[model samples]
Target chain A: MTERFDFEGNAWVLGDNIALDGELMELKYALARETDPEILRHQIFRGLDPTLAERIRPGDIVVTGRRFAHGNPHIQGLIGLRGAGVGLVCESIHSGSFRCAINAGLPFLPRCPGVTALVKPGDRLRVDFATGALQNVTRGERHQFDPLPAELRRIVSNGGWLPTFRQRLAQQN
Target chain B: MGQTLAQKILSRIVGRSVEIGEIIMPEAELVTVHDWYAANAARALDEVGVTELFDPARVMFTTDHEPVAVSPHAAERQQRVREIAARLGIGHFFDVGRGGQGHVFPVELGYIRPGMYIAGYDTHVTNFGAVGALGIAVLTEVSELMALGSVWQQVPQTVRINLHGQLPAGISIRDVAQKIIGELDPDLIDDAVVEFAGPGLRHIGIDGRFTLVNTPTELGARSAIVEPDEIVRAYLADRVDGPVELPRSDPDAPFRAVIEWDMALMEPQVAAPPRPDRVVGVSQVSGTRIDHAYIGSCASGMIEDMRETARFLKGRVIHPRVRLFVTPATNRVAAQMAEESLTGIIQASGAVLTPPGCGVCAGGRIGPVAPGEVSIGTGTRNDPGRLGAHDAQLYIASPATVAAAAITGEICDPRGLDPDLQPREAAHD
Candidate 1:
């Protein structure tokens, strides 16, 4: 399978300290241990923007400020975003959320400092998650940030930790 | 190029020197899962087509949560957990009533030691830091470790917190920990391992250090540890059979930041609802009425905390309006309380004694606060719906403050209570 490193989409700008449990996704869904992306996608961002889930298109990018997905590193939010075919570029993220993003197979740029100032909501943005090159197609601006480390990118590219674990098991067999 | 405690520990695990921000897959020395998550881990293992663990001997399972089968459904879950443990060939299986809290008993039983890299399914596994072991909370990722024998981890920088002076009367380490987390900038501690140092280490015992290490993850810290010294050595001497190695950082170790705090100036602290970091001095929220009071969890259910609560409630009775529940973190702690006669004093003071386990702090599974009620206790978190009802309010503090609240039926400073006051009847307002 080929790993696509580039992503293009419209930006969905969010502020700092967007919590995982109460804000990005509700606590009930996570507590229910619901992993079905179709069900989760409808509930994503319902706390912050009720209509945003319906408006999100495939390949849409979420641009967030520092401390994205700050509280309780539940991966339902990341799974929902990935299910919707959206990518994320945050100014910064907690270590637990960073691990969840990789494990959920969500394409993310976790350390794009000052990224919120680079693009406006609804702007067309193109990102190379492998090379850390972010292009603001709407404004024709270019920016650079550190890419995911090779060790972690491999897990995301393999469609999360489970698939990677399966592959490792197969190799062992 | 001196290495912090975190760097040194990770380097030893991987058999090579590691740098901060570098990802490494080092085999864990010990891994633990409690009853609450054991089923989830079993299901994940089945989904991954794993029939056996990479090394079953290294894995442990304990029935710390729901220890007494609160309901028929809980009974069924416990039965299934036993079956799963048997099926998986887990080496160390502490069934209900055997191990108290998975975090606390491991140290008591000497399963945890200095310079060890361990993993657990629960966040408060940071309690192992009391003995100088780096216990990282892997959440549901424990399944990956069980199957593959290792999981990826990025080395984190270390933050040095230096404490000085001695704590004034009635100020427990929990208060000091709450204040430290409230004041430390989240950015500096985020994704960093906090290393507790300075002269204050001599003043705090193992149980107090557990409270200090257990609270930092709420602020996004990767993990926390204390530099193992004679205190740790003395505590582990009788518990461990083999030679124990105590790890410390180099004098010039590179720390992201250093924070110095004087315990003499510290005051009793209360973490208000909505978040654990919303800490304020006790004077700020005194006299607020409460419906319930709890004093247990991995955070404060140790023997020392029990002694402190007993000391305050010796001859006093709790307010009639408040339902105070005292839970020991482990059965051993309960036994100690009974042997020392603290249990009778606590129960005689009108405080109900629950079974030794996670108690109400485990999502209020055992003792829950009803709607429109307020509670004060030593639980780790006070998030909405944390203790029972979504509308219920929980204020967290040290055991002494909680005892004071139980007596007055409201939040009050423990220091303000008269030590010589006589036992009185339940207050009727």
Candidate 2:
């Protein structure tokens, strides 16, 4: 189901997995294996574990490694995760990810340094999109970050353009 | 008190005593639409009971994103867009391959002009800034503005990036561009306008300038512009109604921030691994084998790209294992390359040249990375799930670098190749 983001104590370890927890079962697969030389050098970004999608839910955050936006900023990656109902929290962002998040209105939480070490695989982490903080229940650590300004936060939270547009329209009339 | 081009344009358009960082909302003169979102916006019009919101004459529409309706599901989506455009009274609808990408065709058709504020749903819509227009990417709030006939925007503070020194041999506009983005934090410039200036500005081509303006969305900048010069005038001369002079910034203009770069010392660089800003010289990542090397996209496909590809691949064949694809940004680019026999050199060297239409650059179609495979391309935006697989990697580079990578199956420097083969002349304007 769906869960609104709530801040909790930080005690989790982070690893890139493409699993989502929700009514819609989703799993992201790697295009190339990590061991392959071709995959190692030219593959988009290695920190992304495609399998993280299998267990993620609406409010859970994705804590990834450096260069989170390493490949093309295909809407499918963020859109698929969003469709499966998960909010993203990454350590760093790339130009392509920045474009995808803004254009499609996806909310991406960036600049959470050492976030991966603070959370574990399959760890239920709490993050507040409003204030830009992460809490790990398992590790008992708290990560702080700068929040998105109201306008940008509005675009990301409404699940990108469509919902954002709908919300803005409601406000006008 | 340095001023940016966006600041100058906003000042002229809004004509208010605006302070730095105060949002200045201007009346947009021309708004464009594609069958995808524009049609969606049109439907919203009917839902809101306001169908005649936008002037049909000023509004334009095109269908590029979903071409030929590969799947039945896709076909249905296309039908919906067409119905919306037809019902909303939009006149300029472009079919697959008929109209070029919205950004290129609008300027070609003389719809976009200098000193005008233009908005489109697509991010690359910023490409129009090359023609000296204040082109900004609009979100749904903007869609509401278009349907209701207005958009709200704060006049953002302006940032002037003084670009000086000629780009050195073996380096390209793309390399310099990535360096700039790498230098800035994405959050620092959100909702701001970025303008490029300085004497070295003359060395950049219009296509290259478009690359910089195009990705402002990534930098969190509200809009971006390059002060128009001979390069812009020459490009716009034949297309405009009269002798169109380029716009320049006032010497005494005010700016919120100013940064400078020495283009000469910049080397052939790559946005390595995961982030566009995680940039490093090709030497650092050299010998990193590549599985696929591609050249051509709206960002890098130009006459210069083809010439570079041919020059690099003249006597060399692509690495046996690395698959290569090249799609010219426009038919004009493709046709010119074919006429010059550059296409022959590219194909004979084992590279596949595909038809235009943003082919693989846009996801869900061609050139996506297969799981863990690595492919270096000239296209912009190397995010996860690009090139087909989330784990797939994409490296950004110039056309020459892309071609050289194809030959060696690694991220090799283009300058390291044969110096005897002269690169093609850079396009003026």
Candidate 3:
């Protein structure tokens, strides 16, 4: 299947040190044993910002700074974002968070300088992920980086590694 | 081109010589998860419509975090995890008491072997590095590990840390770990594989090396390893269930950097409140009063640490103002403490010996730090507001240092307390 690397979304801006266990996702839920993806999809970022619970739309983009999702290494929050069709483009990310975003099939740009400066909480961004081109229509700024390789593009296209891995297992069998 | 230990292991796993910066696929000999992620991992498997795992026997599930299942929610979570493990036909499931901390339990139970590749869900999975396994904390990506049975990898640039000399009286690996945190905080450590070597490494044992492994994960290390030697061979000769293989870095291996330290120069150290990396010599922070003295957590809750705490507090009672909490890391260790009478001596010194679990060190699930309270803890991290109360202050130190602080109701140097507890042999780092 050919993957769609281009996306148009409304950007949501957050700051650095958004903890993986608590702020991005509730540790209590991981502790409380809440695993149903639907319940989790709505609860994402509720603790970070109450409006995030309701304001998030399908295919929205997230903009944040270094150490984004820094603490505790829980990825249920990323799962929620993937379920909601979100894209993450940040100044930098905790390596753990970077892997989770890719694994969860939430297309991400791991490092983008001046991301927060160029986009606000609700700005339209026409992103050509194939070329790493990001256009912030509101501020009239253009940003880009090196795009992912073909192998990674295939993994992301399959909605992260798990599905692709399952297909390989089936194919081999 | 000489290969670092990490490169050697990855090369073996990938069936080819691997280079730094290359992305490769390497399947772990095993993938592990604790109670927090087990049930969720099961649900995710069902969500993806996959019933068969890549290999069921290789997946391990254990319970360590909040083992008591104190709340109804916690109990329910544990129950769900067990049910899912059964449904998945997982061969290695350690429920409640059977498994302590997944990281150390694997080492103690002989599940981890030298040069083996292991992926785990929790951060402290780095603990397996004590036994010379390439145990990486897959964290959020464990879901994929569960489904794919493979871990994605970037062949990390490795830095060798050469430890030299003796750990002088009153010094321990906790101080060494804190020092690594402070010094290895730069880009040199982030995403880099760390290997500990040098003559002083022979002084440390498996349990002591656990302290060093615990510190590197806090710094974003892929793995913190000490190549297994005679000390490890002797430790594993009778303990491991299967044959073991030892992999080492070549004598002239290419390295990102090599760090050398003399242990004799280290004094009793304390990590100042609010962050584990903000370290200072114990004397600099001595006399600062504390309300709580906690001696447990995956980082320092091993028998070695508890024995040191017991030996130091044998004849003396802690200050009346101090509420000292001593929780064992594992039930086996708790039983061993009983057999050795370490529990009796420690509790007699006014410290409460609770059941084995990760408590305040995890977040006040058991003995919480009250708001406005100042505490000295031996947990892995002391991030602000982590231990229940955001307003409370927590200083990180070794168990022996904590025992000293408990006696004085204030931060004090363990070196000055008593010459009675002479330092013993250490483990590999």
Candidate 4:
């Protein structure tokens, strides 16, 4: 199935480019060490806020900074965010992390710096990615963006080129 | 005025062309401010008449350079980022623990994408090129443009890095990056995009690509890119729709510089303090003692990194004098390491594994060394205050080298370890 990502239903509208405005919330270390002998051995991993993890649903849009997927480029982080049903619209991103997200099939909206200023976390938003216009369902705000080139929008809205191609194939079939 | 890629991308998000390096007007798309060089962007935005124009939805903030907030005043300065983000209606804020260094988290959340342009206060923002986007670090002029919804830019000349052979086992993506940076004069590719090509890239995972792409700034390049492949398709399948095809440079495309590297004969390279370009092989630093070791960050914080550490530390204890910390890049990587049983091997080796933030790479996030301390790890930017105090010295190395040093408390070749040693059983999910 070619999963498609559109800004449907209620979405928060941010008018400016406030893509990066969230709590740091680094995963908790499993253990505390003042001074440890082993340099390469230990059992600590990044932990996340269960609440935050659960708060996000699929298709939710995350507005963020340039290098959003900075550290590790862990597929887990991408999967967790994607599984929560959130899409991303940020200003910039790290290359490796971008690949991880794309490979994971996450819906990403790049160069949408105004998203942060246009929407709130819970504000209902509807995005016509084809037209690059996002409507804030909650605050009755309407924001227009330079719509993606029709082809690019198809690729993006259809969840990337593969899905878009599959959808095209289906139409032909 | 004709539009550049930056202007084109920005216009789609914002409604107009914003004056670059000028006072704000209101069409800015997304704005990012870091502790380092943030004042420049802030001042630029202010000068452009944008006291608070960022659309909270389009702003992302991170504290990297001096990981520790430094002075209470510095903490206050950092706090201002949140205040500004909130005041400007910014929705995403990565206060310390929430997001590790700026280069690591935003992309993990799926915010940054391909074919976009980004401006940050720091030089390293160019790391965004790995996913085929143009990441540029600019002064406040661009910040204000972000606030006003636009910035000016010229289409960058491009450079191509063609790989001809596979990397030898026990080698890492970091080595490739360091080797390239070391061999290529920093000035040759200045203000240009460096794209990765050839079959050699296939052996490298995304983490490896991050390592290579992260250091374009040091090379004086504008950005870095790796052509999208099936690996990208498979990775993106679960997130959005399905297989997607992204653009890659043409094989015969004009390039400002072209370099070919054979991965098979490549040796692990290290970037010594004070310059990433000062590269050397493991044989050169043999027996060089280290005080601290870290294995984390977007550059080296993946499952492959953990496995490499385990392979080096298998059935061995860390040197008594060294303090080694291993932080996975994210929760999933840590879980995967556990499942792969690499975590146990690492634990049995006596290293202290940390949580998934940007641990110790930028110094302030986890634990920074005191003055005169020396540490080796797979983190980025060994600048002053990069770890804790500005005087602390950091040596950037591969995960293998970092792990080997952690285990031996001295610089040691990771290849000395038994490569045939099998990893532990996979852990139950």
Candidate 5:
């Protein structure tokens, strides 16, 4: 992933079941047609907050409640998130979406206890996806999320599984 | 610690024993591509600067997603996909009409077997677990699987289900799935596997078991599976060569939770629109009216499902207000239903018969639910906007229940139907 391991950004805190499709990204765009991430950028979270696309600048953070990415694993949504340089700090993520995010190289922190409650909308926050250290500059607190497993971190470092896989096969030769 | 079925399967494929919750990479015996991913998977491999498959013979591709190419673009895509498959030396490409439904055909043709670890590009690949084979739904990372020709899976904790009693009339395995799902919330099954065991396995055969394993994802489980026995062995006798290895969990192997189903107390379960987990029995939903009803999909579109649906519509026509769509799960199922005149019965009863292959089940590209319409169908998932118009109210039910709804033009109980069509003999015997 070209994404940095640690980054500081404004938070867009959301509640539980904040979906990747139909909520964060419009379903018609994410699931049905376009695969280009740049086109996807104009649609992310516009369904939830009509002004989201313009407001969600590069290096922004989304701290959502449990079961993030609740619906189908239509993955182009994550592509949009990565395209806009958005980072995520969620209480949890669904399995399919988790895999999609890993492959798309979207930087996210999952299983972050007390993070959603401490962080408020528009609060400034810094997240280290590698170490699971989430710091809320507004509230002046730091919370430890569960760190990525060794294999997960490796995938994240190399811009997701496919690129890492490509590298591995190349090394073998 | 005694390892679970997942642990044991991973152990065999990796040539070493594994324990629960350990992440291990294992080479797959089979990895299939549906039409949805066939063209993309091929392009993705090329994008990553690769031209060769790890072992082409181990890979399979199918044309089930859009079995009948809907548009010129689709037909052209199909042609290009064929060319790509040939270029890659990919083995076992089940072309349109040949593949039937991607999920169901591999079982019928015998590429999936008990104890074999299979991987596919769709989430419903979990359907493979019905026959006791482990199917890992590689949703987005399929490119990784394509490039690597293997997969990494975290051995999930098993949720044990011990079934008892037979499925009562109006209570198909679909209802049993609901009964099991009623107890599980999304959070409970994040990375879990449901393993079915016990004496009740004698009754649920391949068809019922397929319906059983198909819906665990709605509850967030990674996959659901049944243990392989003589029935499974017999089903795969011709398809699988040599004596098959049916791995079993050690008796004392640990499970995260155990659920015992007393099928006698069960009734047809209905999931009202917008969600599959929000379930109720058929009686509670007796009077809910419907505008449309469906009886197919990879979920409930099968030989047994078609046979079960034929009983209610044998001589009775559906209500005039309802538009009934009955699709066979595969070309083979369509052929079987026609041979037995079951297709004739459904058609003569005022239902529009669609050809085999997932018609409206995949987001209504073929026959999406109409806006303001209320419907019931055997296809999985009633998530809002999943079937058709965002406001469409879609109910998910068993094929029998869907047929009953088709008959009355509303969500009526199949149990309230005339007794002759009911499965009283099987339930009471």
Candidate 6:
């Protein structure tokens, strides 16, 4: 049940204010209460880029500008992104979305002030979710940002909130 | 190095000094879940193999979302909710007819006190901030608090907003809230606790302050609180049994940013469809046709809003083309409306009175607008598909503005209506 703390992946860069409700995944899927990741993976970025989901490979990276996942804190997008086996590095993310990312077990670096300018689409990148070390292999660029708080990291690394809750129960018992 | 009100409350809870961005697990004074998420919370608790709550006395459940249980499925859900509450030994259960909206009634019942920290499953829990309480929207995380007794929270930086001057006649505090959110920089408010202060606050009453505190969550603020003042004290004096602790921020409190607003310059605002922040002066959208109008929600369903609507629609009727629905926030508000004859006046004016709950704002579970129809309301958000039909256009404004639109069948400036019947004392309500 251990998730990787560090990984290398192909980069997919996006702009700011990418909303979670309509742009990430269709709102209807979330309304329908679709939780199976395998079924949701195809809907990731389906609205913005119809073919992007098919193009995304496992262990890929999504580098976004300020206010990534800006709208309603629906976790369907995070669930789908996790299903696509990708991690995220954004200049900023709303607190609600940050919670959803952790709950969905999506590895992300939520604060990288100039990350969008440093990385380009299709670039090879390496990210350490534990240390917030981001390296752009294709461009020979490196940047560091504050990692997720240790308490929150434990939740994400434990594969989302449910497993963490189960562990808490076990500890109490 | 004075701490803001948020830090003060968190520090009191954690039994230690807390700084901004520091993660701390503080026991919640109250944990609330509504009918919409009650079953999911029960399932989560079951999956985690936890059968007991940390303290049943601190936990509350309310059936406000689907108050009437229109469908068989809804009725069955309510039945399961009752069973879950019974099984968990929930201390406070506000069934459909007992309590109104979970957000509004808690304040009316005096469960929310100054400096108290609450964790709620719904975003509008910020409504409790009207009395200086911090009610963070935990969403599905309420289950964790229910089982573990505490949830982790980062002490958020406070955005200090100083208000001055008096609002012009006919303009509601909702307009001031909308204008503030529309004008403030997103970076200043994003994930920050908005603290209301300055002289203008004295002019806003409890219900108006509720609208002020409730609106900022739509702008991504973690929570909003008004520094407890005489107004809060006078409101809670009779409602609460214990000596109220009114906390105030120090003169040198650390604030992420300070923005001062002159309420005199404020105008009636409408958040056009597709987003709540897409705000414009009412004159800009005047004459826009609307088929439906609503004057309720956690944001604007107070008795003050009811009185304001009654003032506008007193001897007149809503346009025949428009269907107006007025929902009081709680049973207390409904009763107050009845006592004041506001209900009869509104009903005589052709507006329908829905149950004293979320009404049409609960995803349009009741009185949904048809597809392609335009509507205006006093609800918190105007997001697409927010009122049932994805294609249906929705605009957000104050109850006075909605009533004005309901009478005119279009988005007209409320000030353009009868001058003698204007809501001059709405601020004092």
- What TM-scores do the predictions have? 0.97, 0.71, 0.82, 0.61, 0.90, 0.97
lDDT score of model 4?
0.61
Writing each residue's lDDT as its tens digit, candidate 6 over A68-163 gives: 888888888999998899999999997788888998888999999989999889999999999999999999988889999998899889988778
Q: Which predicted model would earn the best lDDT?
A: 6
Q: List the residue pairs that clash in candidate 3.
A: B203-B426, B204-B426, B204-B427, B204-B428, B205-B426, B205-B427, B205-B428
DockQ of model 2, rounded to 2 decimals: 0.10
Better of 1 and 3 by DockQ: 1
Question: How does model 3 score by TM-score?
Answer: 0.82
lDDT score of residue A108 within candidate 6: 91
What are the iRMS values of all candidates? Answer: 1.1, 5.5, 3.1, 16.5, 1.7, 1.1
Tens-place lDDT digits, model 3, residues A12-86:
899977778778888777666564557778888877786786788776788887677876555678878776767
Which ranges of candidate 5 are over 4 A from the true structure? Answer: A8-12, A32-44, A51-61, A84-86, A118-126, A135-143, B365-368, B388-390, B421-429
**Stretches > 4 Å off in candidate 1:** A1-3, B418-429
Off by over 4 Å in 3: A1-69, A74-92, A104-149, A159-173, B241-243, B421-429
Candidate 4, residue B74: lDDT: 71
Model 3 chain B worst lDDT window (10 residues):
B420-429
Q: Write the per-residue lDDT of candidate 5 for residues B54-75, one digit (tens) a residue.
A: 7889888887667777799989
Worst 10 residues of 2 chain B by lDDT: B420-429
Candidate 6 chain B has its poorest 10 consecutive residues by lDDT at B420-429
Error of model 3, residue B204, in angstroms: 1.2
User: Every model's DockQ, to 2 decimals?
Assistant: 0.75, 0.10, 0.20, 0.01, 0.56, 0.75
CA displacement after TM-score superposition, residue B79 of candidate 3 (Å): 3.1
| CA deviation > 4 Å runs, candidate 4 | A1-173, B1-30, B35-55, B63-79, B99-101, B241-243, B331-348, B363-365, B383-385, B388-393, B418-429
C-alpha lDDT of all candidate models, in order? 0.89, 0.65, 0.80, 0.61, 0.81, 0.89
What lDDT does candidate 2 reach at residue B142?
Answer: 49
Chain A TM-score of prediction number 4 = 0.59
Better of 5 and 6 by lDDT: 6
**Model 6 docking tier (incorrect/acceptable/medium/high):** medium
